[model samples]
Target: MRATVAGTAVTLTAGALLTAAMTTATASPPATATTPPGTTASQPVLVDCLWQRTVRPIDFVLACGDGNSRLTGLHWEQWSPDKATAVGVNMVNDCKPYCAAGKFHSYRVTVRLEGTEPWKKHPGVQRYTRMSITYADARPDGFKQVMTYPLWG
Candidate 1:
């Protein structure tokens, strides 16, 4: 998956690059082709910049290259194979003069992760391919209160 990161159009395949670096994600149990669909539930994943699957993460970085944008205080409302919802705070840096001297601001957001596909780095694992952010109030400048983005696979 590839999408805009912190208003910058960027594509990342973190899982492919650093598959063995981190192992903190809570992946679903391995599922084989013969496994019954309803017998077991396979939850999707949210991969972080370090190529780690971030399972119901409380804090997620939106800008992987820099610490400019991120989500914090996430309280998951639902977590399933195809969709996940959460309420959190989006923290964005106001790069007025420059990025180096920017100030960070917070915005309330409701997050939704949708779509599922095989995680190439981790077999038998799936990952959310799309992300939508619905801001409650005081959204960032030049951005919509609500927006959807694609996730890296």
Candidate 2:
């Protein structure tokens, strides 16, 4: 009986000490840095474009400009609400060799939305909405360039 009580007391004492040590170690320091007066976080610019009948279901070819020359044959993906997982290929014919330290290239994509009878009543009638493109070198876990484009009248 005495041995069992001593063991229980030792275990309880160890647990109490561990709890106290964790509480002290996990305590956070008070805030120190403050933004200057009248400063605020900048907001991202939203890109919205009007949808035209002819613009529906279109293809875009993008060029990679190295501040002077245009590089062709670069590939990219277009994401939209109409087709959630559509992959469009680039049809660039003349492309220079891939350069590591050149200016980043800009791409254009063509999107197509099938016309629906009920779509006419919709304000934007967005057959598709471009979401984002994941660069080839992007981390597989959770890295991608994501943006939303809203269609407006």
Candidate 3:
């Protein structure tokens, strides 16, 4: 419990820095480009599997089919038109024998969202198309520290 709480703070702090860097690099993006129906952020967003437009979402489900992999306790590092990044913990179920019998585990990870395309469902909203995760420590068995996946629209 203590570790999880501490990790949230670290994630938020890093996200603030990333936002600052993105602001400096992008130099004031168009005021309304990122705004859709509910919010007023100028940077692009990641469309979660549920089809929600999100900026700096606290958590994201990586596996839509089984919910086996997920990123939790996210802190956005930077959010720009071209890219969005965060530091978070990835929780995965290692189904030693089977998913039903699998135990869940958590690992520190750095997540990056990239690419941009107009969302097909919603007008005036752009979504990130790619995602990459790099484990910070203690990755699950038989996996590399880094992995990338194509985010669903």
Q: Please provide, for model 3 over 1-153, each residue's C-alpha lDDT reduced to its tens digit, 9 standing for 90 to 100.
A: 999999999999999999999989789653333454555555677877766677778888998889998999999878889898899999999987999899999999999999988778865677888999999979999888899899877
Q: Residue by residue across 12-37, what tens digits does model 2's lDDT show?
A: 99999999999886784312112123
Candidate maximizing lDDT: 3
lDDT of 3 at 112: 94
Q: Please give the distance, in angstroms, between residue 70's alpha carbon in candidate 3 and its true position after superposition.
A: 0.7
Give each model a TM-score: 0.72, 0.25, 0.71
Candidate 3 deviant stretches above 4 angstroms: 1-42
Candidate 2 residue runs with Cα over 4 Å from true position: 1-50, 54-84, 88-126, 138-144
Model 1 agreement with the true structure over 1-153: per-residue lDDT tens digits:
234563343223555445544443325432232233543337777876666776678888888998899999999999888699999999999997998899999999999999999888877878888999999989988889778888887
lDDT sort, best first: 3, 1, 2
Better of 1 and 2 by TM-score: 1
Model 1 spans with C-alpha error above 4 angstroms: 1-41
**How many pairs collide in each candidate, listed in order?**
1, 7, 3
